[model samples]
Target: MSRLYGDPIEVWTRDGEPSQFVWRDRLYLVRRVLDHWVVAREWWKVREGDPGERQFWRVEASPGREAGSYELRFDTASGGWLLMRAWD
Candidate 1:
């Protein structure tokens, strides 16, 4: 399990459009929202998926400007972004 110690964020997105979210000290540009679904099992995955899980908002981002629909995942361990999914 990963330790989640930081400010949570609220995300706002639209269909087929980029997303926008803000954490505590920085703002994030959502590359894309991927494979959002509800998960009601495996408490372990709850770290990434939680109890009564309703969705997985996957995304991708960098330290600079972003474009198009891309996939980005936030690592709860390092507080960084990783590319998980994307569109061509």
Candidate 2:
């Protein structure tokens, strides 16, 4: 089964795409982007200054050994990145 992290992460990007990230004290290079999507909540459903839109990228990443699938998120309201999920 897949796991959800929701942990804050530091990400590096190239041409507006995620290229690498540091999570839990380990660095991982994004090998391939498996999918990309966006989640946007209705305007009336969110509070002011807390817009409800997030960009998500599902990618294959590796630190050195076999790669793992990771889901990254960018919250528009806070401009912060998070490791949303992972699959081993």
RMSD of each: 8.8, 1.9
Tens digit of per-residue lDDT, candidate 2, span 31-81: 999999988978787668776889999999999989999999998878899
Error of 2 at 73 (Å): 0.5
- Which residue pairs in model 1 clash with each other? 46-49, 59-71, 59-72, 60-71, 60-72
- CA shift of 66, model 1, Å: 8.1
lDDT of 1 by residue, 19-67 (tens): 7765455566765455554335456555653243334454554326644
C-alpha lDDT of residue 88 in model 2:
89
Once fitted onto the true fold, the runs of candidate 2 whose alpha carbons sit more than 4 angstroms away are 45-52
Provide the lDDT at 21 for model 2: 98
How many residue pairs clash in all the candidates, one count each?
Answer: 5, 0
Cα deviation at 62, candidate 2, in Å, is: 0.5
After TM-score superposition, what is the CA distance of residue 43 in candidate 2 from its true location, in Å?
Answer: 0.5
